[model samples]
Target: MALSQLEVTGAEVYATQVGDRLTQRGHQVFYVSDTLSCPHKGQHFRLLFNKRSLPRRVWHVLYLIYLILRYKIQLVHAHSRASGWSSYVACKLTNTPMVTSVHGRQPVHRSRKKFHALGYHAVAVCENIAQQIIRDLGVPREQVSVVRNGVDSQQFSPLPAANNDKPIIQIIGRLTGPKGELVYQLLKQCIDLNTNKVQVVSGSHVDKRFAEFEDKVEFCGYSDNIRSTIAQADLIIGAGRVAMEALLCKKPVFAVGEAKALGYISLDNLPAALASNFGDVADDGKTELDIDYSNLAEQLASFGEQHQLSEQLVAAIKAEYDLDAVCQKLLETYQSAYVYTKQQEVPIIMYHRVTQDDSQKGAYGTYVTLERLEEHFQTIKRMGLSPITFSELAEIGLEHRFNHGKRYIILTFDDGYQDNFDLLLPLLKKYQFKAVIYAVTGTDHNRWDVEHPTKPDQRFELMSHQTMREIDQSGYVEIGGHTLNHPKLAELSEAEQQQEIEQNKAELESLLGRELTTFAYPYGNHNQQTKQLAKQAGYTFTVATDSGPIGMHQDLQQIRRIVMFPSTTKFGLWRKIKGNYTYKKASKQARQIDE
Candidate 1:
């Protein structure tokens, strides 16, 4: 892997772990991380669930691109939900096979998480999880595989009979959150004055919690000999790496209430004892403990032989949840996915306004007036270029290259303006050109009321520029919804975003005798949600204000076009017809010297 692979996860520890694991198996792994994170035990990793902070999450996209390059990577694997999705998109870009190990639980799962879950090769820790992931989560059955976590039996074997030690009950956790206090309380509750001598050690002590527990317990904040800590202990309580380590150390444990259990496990199904904390429990009697701890003390008296815990955990290691096997499976997924990426052939052009003068001078491209537009139209006609709509070009040409002999162009305008009425209309009529205009829906309640170089609605057909109402009743216009507000699509709720598309389509179709099938992305900015909303709203094509010729690889909401203007000179316009628009001379501000 190259340093560029940093685009995928960006979690140094995750990258490091993945790197180290692959290296141990003779595969090279590249690592990149943007910033540090709070250390959880000895393992420091970035949080995947912070919804309010996006820049942190955005740091991983470049790593995603790194994954897209067809490297010899056999498989791709990730630990967290966000990283998993990031990896999937990147790997999918490269047609590489990929998979994710459900690392406990996601911190903040959104509704769109189902789509992320649907894309991966799922590997749960056990069959119970595998089945639940399939039933409750949207993970496809064909892609999901059950891989149990492993334990190092050699180093973590049961303690020797020669060393006589009192029953040491160990609970290990990052001494933060309620679990730290809960462990202390539960240990204080379960160990009896009548039966067992209790001793306790914690791996990670949240410093504040340490002050509180200083008088109550031994403050071994973290330990290098975690295996030994578990081996010496008669019983182990808590979850995560320490819990797994304890089991390998041949110690019995009360393993529950950590990530995999606290968030995912249904509390109601638990024995009136362990179920209270999925989110919050008020009247739900099944969540909190209703059982007597005094009775549980007697139960521990016969809690089987020493290391019986290790024996029972045999299946966990045997399940092949080891990183090696998991990575191998992941490689297969990436290979197939990377091979599947089609060449990025489609050009998604964007446009804004159609007139002779620039609305925002020297910022957006200059506008081409009617005289210049006619020159350009004549050139396209002479070149045998089909003036097709966004949908027609995509279908006839991009679909299996059916129209290989035909050069096609789509005409689109952004921000419904009036010059398109008086200025561009007659020109379109002269050339018999067909085009689509994404009208700003809210200005003057969607009407072209503003008077500019020309009066509104004089030359071109007025499309519904209504922000609140439908546009089809306007007769001469083809209603295309812009948005409720022209805010960037990335910064809106999925519901609000979807509503913008829907309200436009529904109102326009309702008013017009026809159906509304076109959409314009507000502010020419859209994210995954906006794209999805356009699809759900049933639009045939969506236009943006970017520069590219229209074609297929672009999503429905991201089709391309050229903005026609009023000030565009006829001689300059001819150059655009011959692809000068893409050349440096067209871009250069030239000064012709008089001879």
Candidate 2:
């Protein structure tokens, strides 16, 4: 995906590690952490161990023991047998359960014999591997578990693919770790087999972790339009995240994750991620590896079945891992941790601008008089609901604090005009309510040819929004990146897209001396690339202008917002909020009903 800027949605996966899942299981989970890292990527990690100068492997063991003793760890979930042995011994001494997931690899793992002695339970990504755990590894049937990796079907899906003969093979993954290792080998095989005619596009990180792979392959390190790439693919060969994406596109996918065979796992064994599997090309007798090039070329010939296969695969993939089902399972896991966790009832009401005068008017926002501001404050004093800040909303989003029954609302204004301070500040002071103004911070607002000047500016403030360049620290405001160049991010290249998202963060941090926590999509449009870039850029939430009022339950990204027009009435506001305005209607009419 070519995502130049990020969007807000549950689109990005952050360091919500094992214990968090266990907490979802409704178990009494204890979280211990002393350090935190950036939140933009799929996995969020803390310093489970950090030794400044020590080789990471050596210190990793020492830190493991330290954490086990410090926290009195009750269970250990390891991805490899070597890690399992370490966990098993510590858990045995601690009388803890060592439930480990294979996470698909074998190169550096300890022997199955050693793993057996560790009293560890094995979890595999697919059933075939679960059987292997029971049969090949001698783990008991009950001790092995299978959980097919899931995809957000709503986020990634195939387009009506084109019947083009220039076959493109799409592969997305990190340049290092299992993903990098897999790509390294697979690309080499393609190279040696002399299949240069097939276009290969790969997406992943090329940071210090996977930098070595740069020399061996033409890497498309990051993207916003991941779905587009998949749609272009004649076939997709990947592991982990990319494989799941391919299935979403309903493309024929080939995957490998088992380190035992260079992570060469089969797509058929995967969840109904594809309409049908394009089985691996078996090697001819003359080739060293067990795959054939001629057969692969013949297999690639099936690229013409684009839409036909996409339609077929959609049902299969949806049946396996739709969001509703996945969220339900995750809900069970969360409920297990705390059986009483209920639907959070704190309704998040949003407001745009507030004016001290009742009659001063603007389009799409409320204008309150000083009397109305005081009346609202008096109501807060009498107390049925409380006002919360943007940061607090973020904590709720991260699930750090759950709102029990408190009625609450958040104030946000778009277009960061000077009137925010002029008209709203006095009223805000009167009520003592905290309001967040989402500033445009760019010339978009001030760039009036001395023409059509009064059209957009309302009583507001301004912040840095110049395509996310260096932040200006005029402490009166909080700054964030909208993008270096605010093109719809899904339209950029992988490298250019990554630069658009990351460079702004760097620029802003350098200017503001703090990391930016908020982002608003330039025009409220984003794709897979934008979501990933936002994650990589470490935004807590990305706001959109096109959506409806953001409910508390909405994913942090994909957060909805409703803008009232100057022509709106209160009755219509409530109705729009109730979600009565249909998306289908909005799509057809090319309009969103304000009411």
Instruction: Tell me, by lDDT, which candidate is best.
Output: 1
Local distance difference test scores for all models:
0.48, 0.47
lDDT of 2 by residue, 1-595 (tens): 0000122111122112333333453433432222322123222224332223446535544555676677544345454444454455555655544555554422222565444742444545555455555555566886565544455576676655546555556655555544455455565544332332333453334545334445544556455566766676666665455555676776656554323121222333333222111121111111123345445444445444433443545566666655545444433333222211121223333344455554655443444444544554465545445555556566554333332334554445554545556555556566556555554433444332123345553433343344223212322234546665455666778777678677766765675567777666655767767777787778877666555322323355555555554444445444443322433333444543443
In model 1, which runs have C-alpha deviations exceeding 4 angstroms? 1-21, 31-52, 63-75, 92-96, 106-110, 192-212, 240-244, 259-298, 301-595
Q: Which one wins on TM-score?
A: 1
The lDDT of model 2 is: 0.47
Q: Candidate 2, which ten residues in sequence have the lowest lDDT sum?
A: 1-10
Candidate 2 segments exceeding 4 Å error: 1-62, 68-75, 105-111, 117-120, 157-167, 173-218, 222-234, 252-289, 305-307, 310-312, 322-595
For model 1, state the Cα shift of residue 558 in Å: 43
Candidate 2 lands at a TM-score of 0.40
User: What is the lDDT for 467 in model 2?
Assistant: 27
lDDT agreement of model 1 with the native: 0.48
Shift in Å, residue 39, candidate 2: 4.1
User: Local error of candidate 2 at 346, Å?
Assistant: 29
